[model samples]
Target: MKSLVFRVFAVFTLVLVAAVSGCGQKGPVLNVYNWGDYIDESVLHDFEKKYNIRVNYDTFATNEDMYVKIKAGGSTYDVLFPSDYMIKRMIDEDMLEKLDFNNIPNYKYINDSFKNLEYDPNNEYSVPYMWGTVGILYNKKMVQEKPDSWGILWDKRYAKQILMMDSQRDSIGITLKYLGYSMNTKNPKELEEAKQALIKQKPLVLAYVVDEVKDKMIAGEAALAVVWSGDAIYCMRENPDLDYVIPKEGSNLWFDAMVIPKGTKRKKEAELFINYMCETDVAFRNTDYIGYSSPHTEAVKKLPAEIRNSRTAYPTEEDMANCEIFAHLGSMLKEFDRIWTEIKSN
Candidate 1:
């Protein structure tokens, strides 16, 4: 009897020890992939310290690069920051996981206008990170009058003094908008028109670039350029003469969202991170650090009056209504790429 009792006690002790050891061990970590210099680094560090989980971050210059890498299964990333159109494509490819909203309590702080967007109509798969427009940013000192039209980029006066984003989407989309066609237009005729317009303007530009446009524009290397609102904001800080404007014709309205990638083992942690970013205070911190607009309504309310009222950040209702949010163009993207390559090579 005593031997049987000893055996039972020994087995129970081993089971308890195994369970406790498992409980103490950490789970798989999070891998975050995002745009370069798009977020505040401190927020990431604080998240790591608070959660006791390691976060590995990576960056891509363009969404196409990110899509290609992710689709190739080159790396396993727990989270990705993608713009609206890319999110649509990712969803169609089943690359993103459906978010567990209950875990993201701070989501309620997001502006209602930002929710139910065409890309994530139900908001089941992504959370808004930053929202802005693609517009003209110019050095006022070089131009006697502010540029309110896309044609300013093609003006003979600004020749060799213009910089344009190297991105296929922004460059093509803006030309399409300038031509009075939908940025998401798949119409061959409209696309051809946009292509011709770009070719005409190509000789006038200093260079097609993404990063350092702010610095170049501020240093007076370029007098006018098409730039993202966030980048425009950065330029304004260095040179007060810098001005951002949504062309009277229109511009692309872009929203980048944080999403959990499929196959992530840290779903709970990923959800927590999203919620943490959505919190009013945290959202404000990110906007302050990144100099972009926050989509959280409560956070927007707390921003400085000058920032909250900046027409460039939050355009008037009429201007907002005129702007079209980019939609996934499917196969039309290939056509754009071919033309873009030809344009750049020439």
Candidate 2:
């Protein structure tokens, strides 16, 4: 998710009534790792100013990249922002610490609908942050016909004008969905089919990009792109010519959440930071600034009606019925990696 927020009409009524209290004494730097360009940088500035606890904020481009760095035993990250399936994988591997919900009192503001997700069924190790769907973002001027199916991505006319995600999980997962297979398919044959499908479509794709896809789409540089809904919102505001859709074939409904690592020495401080992030104003700032869907009930209520009701950001339940939350792949992830490498190289 990235920023260039909505018109949001004029000013919203969201307010933070009380100033946060400073940590009594200086503590070790709170090492936080999150997705690149996914948050409002000013939030970190404010959190720092409030707590007097220095934050060493860093970012990763993908979940796999972050997992590898954290799993290798050299890096010391205290808090991580990982998507649903990756969070499950980290928990299974014992890489995450069980969150002490008592410290996250603001958790009460989180929507019940977003709670108890399969990836964190018990809600023990992770806290929901931003959620969104994967869909097609296209320039309305360039695409005259309805871009309602993933199959359009393969249409010959759109060749050299389509952007696919650079991430292995997303690009491969959508291809699996397009082929009537589970995105978490552990079946070798099903995965092979998705792999072949992507290889065939490679010639049609203009580029494999992540965040850059947003800028390119906003500038009307591409006819279509596989993008996160949050990015689609940002692009739509910048270029009304841009629009988004969850294809008829269905797609991934994803959640990115916060979790502390297993070996953090500053656990309580990390909890404080997490609670602070969930505060109404902070949550609203992050959601508005980044254009992502916040799980915080109060924060969402504070959003302008346009954003609150935007079909792109919040699809109807019936439309969402076919969508799936990604599941931890375990050993099958290696197969996904192999398929992705071949797709990119082929």
Candidate 3:
């Protein structure tokens, strides 16, 4: 009788400890993974406090890195922000979960131009986050006159003072665009022409970088560099003389979107978060923090006049007509990657 009583008492103590531990624990938790420095920290803190949910934020350097980790399986990422091309690739691989729109009531505020994109047609998979173009961020005083052509990147006077993107895809794609070929072109001759152009310009470059364009440009390390729109905005703020312009030879119009990863346990919570982010004010806050253009029309209207009117932030419609977004090229990616490695190796 004594042994039985002790066993029963021990089991009851264990059960009580488990129940107390569960109650003392925090509220719902959401894991959000995104690009580094991509969004405002205050916004995240505010979201967490408002919903009483713990948000475990994480970041990745590139889309490829993000894709590899998610593909490993059983990773718990409720939301992911990736470029259009990556989103298309993920969807093709069935790696993304379908979004439930009912929870995302603010979806209607998105601009029509950014909606129903080719990658997520019918609006089933993702929500557009930010959209802008790749262009030249230059120092106006050094150049004297604004460059209107891609050829300016190879100007002899700028030799050893020019900077270029370190990204293989973006660098090669821009070169192809400058040469009047499709960024996704598979033509061996066209690609070779672009390769030659890159080599000719390589000697002129100070450095090839992805994340340091703002710092280097601010410090006047390079007179000019190929930069994404968001980085250009931040760079302009870093130096009063700096300016951003889309080249006459055309440029890449890139778009990023938020999508739920496959097998996310908190599907409803994920949708709610997406909807919250899509709100006009919330989108504006994100753009202001990251220095990017907001694809949400309502959000754009809410921006300060200086930001909305700035040419670097909101290019005229005519400028936009000259840009193109990258598309998934299936088998050609390996070839592009091969050429990219060759360029870096040499």
Provide backbone clash counts, one per model.
Answer: 0, 0, 0
Q: Give me the runs in candidate 2 sitting further than 4 Å from their true place.
A: 1-25
Model 3, runs deviating above 4 Å: 1-25
lDDT of 2: 0.89
**TM-score for all predictions?**
0.88, 0.88, 0.90
In terms of lDDT, the best-performing candidate is 2
Worst 10 residues of 3 by lDDT: 20-29
Tens digit of per-residue lDDT, candidate 3, span 1-346: 9999999999999999999767637777788999898898888888887788778799998888999899987678999999999998999999899887888889888888888877888889999888888999999888878889888888999998899998877899889988898887889999988888888888888999888888989988888899998888888877888998998778888888999998888888888888889877789899888888888889899888998998778888788776777887788888887887777777
| lDDT, candidate 1, 250-298, per-residue tens | 9889899999888887899889888888978789888988888888998
* Alpha-carbon RMSD to native, per candidate: 7.8, 12.0, 4.6
Backbone clash total for model 2 is: 0
Model 2 scores a TM of 0.88
167, model 1: CA deviation in Å? 1.8
